[model samples]
Target: MRVLVAGATGVIGRQLCPALVAAGHDVVGLARSAPGADAGLAGVRIVVGDALDRSSIQRAVDEAAPDAVVNMLTAIPPEIDPKRLAEQFTLTNRLRTEGTRNLIAAAGGVERMIAQGLAYAYDPHGDGPANEDAPLWRKPPKPFVPVLAALRELEQSTRDAGGLVLRLGHVYGPGTIYAPDGSLLRQVRAGKMPLVSGGAATFSFSHTVDIASAVVAALDSDEAGVLNVVDDEPARMSEWLPFLARLIGAPQPKTAPAFLARLAVGSWGVAFMSQLRGADNTRAKNALDWKPRYASWRAGFATELGGLAAADAS
Candidate 1:
């Protein structure tokens, strides 16, 4: 298989490109510059392309002439302010809605097409973790409306193109918010992150290594539609926050009232911390014949972040 990967220099791309190569696929990675920056992607042929530009995307796709196309484009900032998540996600929204259309046009001849999606967008009114078929948030906060709309557009377009949408869980592992030096860890250490309104929202986490493995499996399969690629465990914020703090030797997080929390992280953040729903990965595991290496954040945090914290201290 000749696979063309957009956003090849990103955290997931850096991991996915090499995995595809190791699986005996000829990989062509789209980059913003030639001779891509990541040395980890040794075998992937790099081609400069602008995902948002129609002409540039067509040229790159033609140059690569790949058998499959993977859309991994994103523009998330490192230090996120939950209050401004919708504003912060503006570029990422474009990439999903606009850039996705450009790539789909360029990849018309490709045998397989896959794009990233979010698993956590399901309505919070559900009783348990959401399956892929669950209703998405109908009335998201004003800030999240655009983001949710973009996600819907992205998923619809990909399905129309007969492509698979991997609705991934909250991603962790190296170069991610769960990483030793990432923004989330910094906040946790600084006591800036708190348990908002008892943090009732449930979170389903996926490590980068597991996410890459799932992408590889998706490429090898003929299945199409959406699948939630998450770990086996779904933990609440209240359950995970204190555990993470204790594991990383950080101060116990304080609980903030909903109104007070809103002033800091906005309504969207309050909902995220208190009302968000976790996703069910049963379909993905059954379809892709895959399972995450770290099936629970409890174990993942103990081994990954805990070890890293120990190393940094030593």
Candidate 2:
């Protein structure tokens, strides 16, 4: 299969392109600039194009002539401003909605289209992890409304184009917030992040490597609609945060009142960190015939942080 990947230099794309190549797919990567394109994408043909520009994307797709197109485009900032976190989702929202439409237009002849979706958009309800059929947050908090709306638009457009949507969990790995050098890690080390109350919000995490493999599986899959790409474990923030801090050799996180947390991180952020629902990956695993290498964040975080510790020691 020939695959064209937008946002090919992004955190997930950087891992995915190479994985696709290894899986015997000819890959073309859409990059905005020459330097933005990673030289490490050994066999991937890099096409210079901005996803926001329909003409550029169309030209790149024409040149690539791919059988499938993967929309991995995002514009999330490396460090989110706590007071202005809502602002951070603005450009990414555009990418999810407008950027996705442009990509679909560019991939006119492509038969298979796989898009990125968020597992976090599900309404925080039910007794267990949310599945694909669970309702999206109808009335999401203000900061998350646009983001969720864009995600819904993206998924709807993809499905309308006969594509598959992977509702991925909170991604954490190298180049992501869980990384030793990532923003979240820095906050943990600096004691800036705290658990709100008992931190009961449940989260499903996905390692980048696992997510890349899932993308590869989805590439050839005939499965349509949404599939949650998350780990086997669904843990509460209190369970994961202290564990993560221990793995990274940081002090145990302090607890803040919900009001204090809302004041510090905004209502959306507080809700996201302390009240979001977790997603189940059973459908994806069965449909894609895939299993995550890192089954749980317990093992994943330890190994990832352990690697960093070893590197630093060396």
Against the true structure, candidate 2 reaches a TM-score of 0.96
The reply for model 1, stretches above 4 Å from the true place, is 35-39, 312-314
Report the CA-based lDDT of candidate 2 relative to the real structure. 0.88
Quote the lDDT for 137 in model 1: 95
When summed lDDT is taken over every stretch of 10 residues in candidate 1, the lowest stretch is: 31-40
Clashes of each: 0, 0
- The residue-by-residue lDDT of candidate 1 on 274-311, one tens digit each, is 99899999999999999999899888888777765576
Question: After TM-score superposition, what is the CA distance of residue 111 in candidate 1 from its true location, in Å?
Answer: 0.8
lDDT of 2 at 266: 86
lDDT of 2 at 103: 90
